[model samples]
Target: MSFFVSDRAPANRVSGYKRRIVLYCLGALLLLLVAVAMGAAIGETAIPLDVIGKTVANRIFGAGYTLDPIEEGIVWSYRISRAIVAASCGAALAVSGAVLQSLLRNPLADPYLLGLSAGASTGAVLVTVIGIGGGMVSLSVGAFWGAALAFGLVALLAKAAGGGVSAQGTGQIILAGIAGSQLFNALTSFIITRSANAEQARGIMFWLLGNLSGVRWDDVWLAVPVAVGGVAVCIWHMRALDAFAFGADSAASLGIPVRRVQVVLIAITALMTAVMVSLVGSIGFVGLVIPHAARFLVGVRHGRLLPVTALTGAVFLVIADIVSRTAIPGQVVPIGVITALVGAPGFALILIRGRRMR
Candidate 1:
């Protein structure tokens, strides 16, 4: 009688795949840690990396590292908070961009493609310059309501224009987003001009350009959860998002419940974008450029694309924030300025390569 032997090659392959994924995850986490440390160490005060580490350790785990109070305060209270917020903001925007680009079937789709950022700006200006909230509602609260209003208007217009979740519907949504953005931007400008106060204009315009200087631990609490939750929600719909590549009809044919998936994901995107914009102002390019870069690196598979895109966006924005702080001798530039400088060229390259492939 021959002894039966079991084949374990398939098991080995499965184990190998799991090991590879773990390696990728570990590598990404290490990179993020290094980037965050750099963000804390290389700022205006130039804290040492060891001090940054000790501060973090002392704060998180009570390591008792006996660091200087000033250094610890700077790292723990200021730089670390800003860096983490940058990471959170970047991840949220990038995930939103990927979702919008997939759902809308538009290469240029971004978080602000729904007019959320513009409406948030309008709302913040109304509260700040026009005093619509009468010193009661905060800037973030006004921005959220404004974003909700703009989304409602855009939804109605898109529904009227195309009537269903079809190919035409995506196009109408884009057009509606553009129209809503223009309207809200005009409103923001009108309110600012009515105020006619250069100081307020200067301050709010700087914030509108994208400012992270005001970020703190409280902002971190708001930002990190939204980014993590947004990514988790997107990952849950990875299969549906992949099916969406062939258009709504194809997605529906694949049992995707196209309309429901679209609505849920779009709402998630809007919520993530509104929260981040309210926290950090409207920084561009993280959402628009990072997804294309991830797609280029990982191909078009959403399962692999979403997490990688979020990590890349987080690292890129942390670096951008660093640049914004140190790009000049004694002045901090708006984070948007740095992102635009990098993203414009990056997007041009993506378009050129895409055309060549076509």
Candidate 2:
């Protein structure tokens, strides 16, 4: 009689894989720090490297240092806020992208394609063109609602199509998102065409393209909480996200209660995405493209994939923002434009490769 024994080799292989992933993540994190420092140092005013060093040190440690008031003001106020927004928006978009891709089981999935960004842009454009908000904060709130409405509509449509959240055939949901995006985009164009104010028109136009300028500290407060909460929600559902890799039925067989978990997961992602898009306008490509890149690096396991994607995204955007500001001295290019230029080609390549595979 032969006794069956459990194999330990597979477990060891898994352990080795995890170790390599950890080491890669550490290296990525260090690169992210370098990217951030470069972003902070090389902006419009060109803050000295020493000044950048000192300001960061001051913020990181409670250490005392001296600098000219003008230099201190520039580093602490203008440059830092923009850089922080850059990183925050990057991480938020990246993680949101990862969540959306996993939810839909499609690499092409992104926040804007799902209509969240366009919807939010429409709401905020109305405010910008009509001068609805007496204050900046109120306008952000308007954008948030618009974004939330778009998200809701998509969710409703997905449920109607027999895949409320857990259904793995994402073709229907993706089509719905595209339709929703077009609807909102047309509405936004209508608003812009009817507007009487040129300044408002320009502002609305710029916002739609996406930018990191005109950002103040108050915007950070709004963006940070939503992003953090979204990340937390995603982390909690990492296992569920992993289950999605094999499609919904496989997940349900594994006792994941696919439908219920999916609705909650999508809802959380939509909320977080709306807030970020509303704050920064429709920054495209980062959410869609970054996750695919991360997957290539770390595979599709959401446990490791999510955080790595987030960090890579943050690094990408920070570098993008730096280029936007400094690429031409007088013109502050919109951050969204930069991301699109970088992300669109990669997306097209992914689509082509996916088609070939099919």
Candidate 3:
């Protein structure tokens, strides 16, 4: 005598799914704004959020809002620049991770895992120590070349190992990447030890561990555009990335030029990584961990996944940078250390979850 209840239709289900995606994106954006504010406001000297807003408004609009020079310097010059750089680097690394994971169809794939960071680091070190390209050369230029070299080597090695940007070839590529990273890292260590003095070594060590202490507007200008552009490019290629999730054969059958897409995406990733590493020196884990965390929230669709991952990474790293500066009263911990401490545990959880799913 009971009446059957009406079932939800497919259109309704799709609408509901989209609603959830929108909500997730909005939430992430809100969190990112809060994190940015916190990062700008909380530091060695704790500028208020109101002061931050006034300083920003005054700068943009030439409003007559006035603050002490020290407050202005702390809020406008230092904290804001550092936060922006952290956000840019985080977004770049996360986007690179998402691209790499999709390209390789391997959960653990990241820009650093592919040797880009080590290569860039080597290039920067060479420039710093040996004065490569004469004294006029910038570290960013060296990093760009270094990253390109590493990428080329990894591709060559992968090709020799019979890995041609396909899922079946992922293991070979990973091994090649590991080898390339070790080789570059060894070269970097040797150069530092052989050439750099103790003071120079200390500076290099801090940079290698990832420092944001000296980030200025110039760094913000350098990093933000590249990161934003890179993210845009990845989003434009979301369809190809989606095809890649199914493997090369399937992607090719779906009319995606698998090799071409792989090459382009890998180049973009390397470019972004090099830019960030050049500015901040090789911060890790954002690329390795953020994509997986985003996937948990947004599913595997790159449209939703990429934006969420980028936003989450921006928020995560800004907060991490805040902790790095404030954690020790008289000393600033390297941003990399905080990320590793946070990311390692998160990574372990991901491993446990993956095992359970399998």
Winning model by TM-score? 1
lDDT of 2: 0.79
Best by lDDT: 1
**For model 1, where is the 10-residue window of minimal lDDT?**
1-10
Overall lDDT per candidate, in order of appearance? 0.90, 0.79, 0.87
Residue lDDT tens for model 3, 194-253: 999898778878888888887899989989999999999999999998998888889989
Collision pairs in model 3: none
Question: Given candidate 2, what's the lDDT at residue 223?
Answer: 71
lDDT of 2 by residue, 249-293 (tens): 888889988877777777777787787777777788888899988
lDDT of 1 at 89: 89
**If the candidates were sorted by their lDDT against the true structure, best first, what order would they fall in?**
1, 3, 2
Ranking the candidates on TM-score from highest down gives 1, 3, 2
User: What residue runs in model 3 are displaced by over 4 Å at the alpha carbon?
Assistant: 1-28, 163-169
lDDT of candidate 1 over 261-338, digit per residue (tens)? 888999999999999888889899889999999999998889999999999999999999999999996888999999
Error of 1 at 200 (Å): 0.4
